[model samples]
Target: MDTQNSAGTLYIVATPVGNLEDITFRAVKVLKQVDLIAAEDTRHSKKLLSHYDIKTKLVSCHEHNEANKTHQIIAHLKNGLDIALISDAGTPSISDPGYKLVTAVAREMLSIIPIPGCSAAIAGLSVSGLPTDSFLFLGFLPKKQQKQKQALEAITNQSATLIFYESPRRIKALIDNMRTILGDRKACLAREITKLHEEYIRGNLSDILKALEEKEVIKGECSLFVQGQLEQKTIDEEQLEKIIISRLATTELGTSDLARQISKEFKVSKKQVYDTILKSNQIDS
Candidate 1:
């Protein structure tokens, strides 16, 4: 509890991602006492505050308005008004927009307190059943397929569990790209975290993809946790063929050109794709 004496303080509060019960006692008290709340989404914050019967003034402080709002928030703080900043879900600035405001406030010698609580990223990793000692948090992959694949390829060699947030619409495509870039590594797809419909699909990329296909439609926010590289069998012909097909769908390249491209992307052999393409063509014919 770092509250400035005679000056207003900035409280960086963490709200529940799914389960409301996950909120901490100190967080609730600070929210109630704060003169103003700078939230990523005021309407969303209102619901949380109403749930606890705590009515406090809330102002929008998201990525879109953070730059403009930071000055206003600081002005209020200088006038001795204590403010609390929170995100729509989880801790502010984890994957949200509180960093700028925090930095601005600190530069002015104002106290900033962090009221930590539930975070879906940590929640998923804690029970992911994967290696957790060293992990990297990749907030979200690029929307473009090629860029996303390139990003995944860059981190494929890291010996740490990789955690990422993904939307349901792109989850399948992401998993497909991951399978291409990272091979059939052990992974878990945790969704509807902390809620009643919470589910964790654990296995290699292929198995998880099959499980997702069986579902009518995947729902909720998703956190994808992937195990790092280890001593495993090399990527087989079938996997190479799948990557070739995926790239072909998204890019215009001949079988020979595609084979070379996939080989370079996954650090595999062009012969592997050439042979797999030959086998695939035989099956199709």
Candidate 2:
């Protein structure tokens, strides 16, 4: 309903993740009405558009070319040509391309609309059976082994449910890493969601790893929903101080970073950790 004066609106459309019928009626109408559709993959999106008989012109706007395409998209918007942005599946900019274009459009004081429909993360979370009252949607983890561990260690004490997206090829490796870092926590692995072979493996991280090992080859993208730290043990001040001092001696992490990591790991106040760190620094000085 809200439209830019004379400029065209940039609609962030959400397409089906797998099953075509999963799309909403509103999304279909917008795709049909838009002057042009900017897709992450034109060839891949053509199948969906063809299924619904949407004949709107398609253009490439994927990660590789998104930078060059952003300026072009803005020029079209300035010329009053409404555009719809979509990805190969699910919503654009959700671990997909479109963030840069959206940001550029907003800065130009142009109208940016959202034609919300299906999101893989939300779809996976809805049926994950994990506590959804509070959640942390970490779209994907770092690829490097050490960086991956660092990322996992940073959130080791998060209380909210954790949601992550991973490729089928790397799903098993990710689970192995998680098991090593987060313990054998309860989890749900949603694979090939909304498709014929859609499967949900519910159990501990170890169970999921075993399941992956049994399979000949994993297929499709995967969403891993893991339970957060459900218990926090009290840390004695003296013991915590010694632990912090030892960590400082071994790691190059600064005061703030060390305090955060220690507080999360120990379930203590960051201020407490900071005070201990400061006192230790004074003593060493």
Candidate 3:
């Protein structure tokens, strides 16, 4: 209710990730009352709007056009047209569109409202059944496998639980890679979150990999959570071997990125990580 002024407000509304009924009453009310709704996918959001009988006008605000659309939205707001910003699902700007628009609006001294609700990351973490004392939300790994491994290698020795968003197509590969890099840590894969076909597979990386292998073809987006390395404050030589072997198996980086990352992580020189890889006899010199 931050729209007490005549200047239009920008409401960052959170819609359901999967279940339509998961939306809050306040969100529904704002969506119905807003002058305009800047949606990530106007076509996809139409279903939700129609379902709720909200007749507010919608404008596309996806990644490809967010910059241009931000100015248009601001013009409307300045003209005293309250606008609601929403993504196809969940809250906007959480690995989705809406950041630029929010920043632009903030500079204009506009009232930017937040209507928080369900998020796939939080939903997956709450039931991950792992130690959630501290966690990291890695939105998505790099598309390049080596870059992804490099990113993983950087945090392999961290003490916080790791959460990642992965698509179904690459779910198997991600597990295989994680199994190699993170060792056999406890993990959970939450699929089709908040939907009818939602499923949670809880176990170690190997267990989940085997379970996924048994499937014909997995469906839906997945939220993977991995327990952190806590018991061993420091990585032992044996643990380093496992880490090296795993990265070699899944990464295309050969030894460069891995070497640089592990060297920095373990407080050693690049030569050390390179020497470890050479000893593993996996990569050529």
Give the candidates in order of lDDT, highest first.
2, 1, 3
| Tens digits of lDDT, candidate 2, 247-281 | 77975567877786677667788899999999999
**Overall local distance difference test of candidate 2:** 0.90
Give a tens-digit lDDT track for model 3, residues 94-160.
8788888888888888889899997998888999898777999898898889999889888877889
Q: Candidate 2: lDDT of 196?
A: 97
Better by lDDT, candidate 2 or 1: 2
Whole-model Cα lDDT per candidate? 0.86, 0.90, 0.85
Candidate 1 lDDT, tens digit per residue, 72-143?
A: 998898889999999989989887899899988888888888898988899999999998899999988899
Q: Clash number for model 2?
A: 0
Against the true structure, what is each candidate's TM-score? 0.83, 0.82, 0.82
Model 1 residue 110 CA deviation (Å) reads 2.2
What value does the lDDT take at residue 115 in candidate 2?
Answer: 88
Which 10-residue window of candidate 3 scores lowest in summed lDDT?
260-269
Better of 2 and 3 by lDDT: 2
Stretches > 4 Å off in candidate 1 = 1-5, 231-285
TM-score winner: 1
